[model samples]
Target: MLQASFGSQHPSSDARKVADWALRSHDNRQAAFIIIDKRAARLYVLDEAGRLRGSTSVLLGAAHGDDTVPGIGQRAISEVRPGERTTPAGRFLAERGHNGRGEDVVWVDYDAGVSIHRVLTSNPGERRLARLASPVLADKRISYGCINVPVAFYETYIRPMFARQPAMVYVLPEVKSVDEVFAMAASPQR
Candidate 1:
């Protein structure tokens, strides 16, 4: 296990410590859901038994920001904008699915246009494809506010979490408070 130290001045120090502890002790045996830390770039999958099944690397949003709806006649808002490669930190749900131009993908309703999906890498010339598959991307923040993963990996492992019930995907900039995220999840529209 990794350990991080925060000075007392941190705004959410207590919350961060608690979240860190939860992450460490998460038993994936019957987790049914997961919460990915953008900064950590780690995928924590819990099985039906709630034991920590294991962790894997993932590619995340290259640009980070709040998800917003675009006004009519305006440029469509992108969940991830170029050069802002930081994924938003919050709690979200895997609420839907989409035909990602032919690739199968599970859509995570981050409420910010950001969703976790299969990494698009059909083109040989795309440099991002290599990065998307790198182990380095797993434990660090990357992507445009969306979690990207190997298509087969998602189909084999992560998809089951959303089978009978909607699964939660909590993304955080760093280990911080979960109150806001939990509140959002408990909201009526969620």
Candidate 2:
């Protein structure tokens, strides 16, 4: 129960629920944080005070699972099956870093090779840009576990937040309950 406000931005019910829990329980550790609502295909960036910094639609894994397949990160991208591609749900202490390509990214789970970076338009056939612009939720699911955001959004919101310190990223589960994914010591059922 946040007495004040979640923020000026209007997030989905699930996103607000997780954000409220994180803020009330001090789960964000006074750091900037993000809430990714998988079901809604949206991402919310908030400051330490739980004020909305920005929000945007994002591209998630092609698969619908909340957990990543074991050892999938160790394998080449080409070897990963469609079903193995999943942006795992849970809280991640994410940090800003660069990929092998030297592009800046917010590493959600470095071990899992999951990061939040600008959308890739390398393959026109994938129509990543088109998918991003589409209002359809299903069109947003075409990434390989990584979270893809618009270039401007990534630069203006996500990058600066993680440039100096690590931040908490809570990816809400699609198949599991919020309680199951977070299991916060202070979380009470709504």
Candidate 3:
């Protein structure tokens, strides 16, 4: 039940950079999410909105490769890879839940079985899961194919975004053309 107001000012270095860019570019009138490919990361938050509020970073699926499933769109690096690791590109939704640590998380259910939850750091192997780890996990990639945000950010901004129900989480391969992806997502699934 943590609110967005709690950590509105303490965005991560990456999140702060994205917010600054977005605010200057968009004038903070709309809500936006940024995907950082080179870093295999993502940022979610409400724009300026007359005041800064809510933010978090996520581990993405692997970059494109031969093992990527075609028609499923570009794979993000943080997604599960059968036995490796990978994330997928396309539109998605963020639900809510608690991780093993019992921290509130935004459950981004994208590719089947893939979800973004709080960093679950209970063991050694789990620690090396992703590049970004909290003081707790410090090294685990627990997601199957979804983005994971720190508990603090998730509760502050993400939770409220979905309060109205059905919040959209768009995943693009890069900053390239998103028309095709959006069009396909809007069209009925055949």
**Candidates 2 and 3: which is better by TM-score?**
2
Candidate 2 — which residues are off by over 4 angstroms? Answer: 1-9, 186-190
User: Which tens-of-lDDT digit does each residue in 1-190 have in candidate 3?
Assistant: 1122224355444334433443444422245433322133545455333243444455544333212354342444444355444455444555566554575555554334345565445666654344564433223234454566666665666666656554444455443344444443233121
9-101, model 1: which lDDT tens digit per residue?
232333344334434544222235565655556666644433455455677755444333332113343432464444555555665565435
Against the reference, the lDDT scores of all candidates come to: 0.52, 0.87, 0.45
Model 2: per-residue Cα lDDT over 11-99, one tens digit each: 66778778888888888887778999999899988888888878889999999999988888788899999888899998888899999
**Candidate with the greatest lDDT versus the true structure:** 2
| Candidates 1 and 3, the one with greater lDDT | 1
Worst 10 residues of 3 by lDDT: 181-190
My TM-score estimates for the predictions, one after another, are 0.62, 0.93, 0.51
Show model 1 residue runs off by greater than 4 Å.
1-31, 64-80, 83-86, 99-103, 133-142, 175-190
Q: Find the candidate with the highest TM-score and give its number.
A: 2
RMSD of 3: 8.5
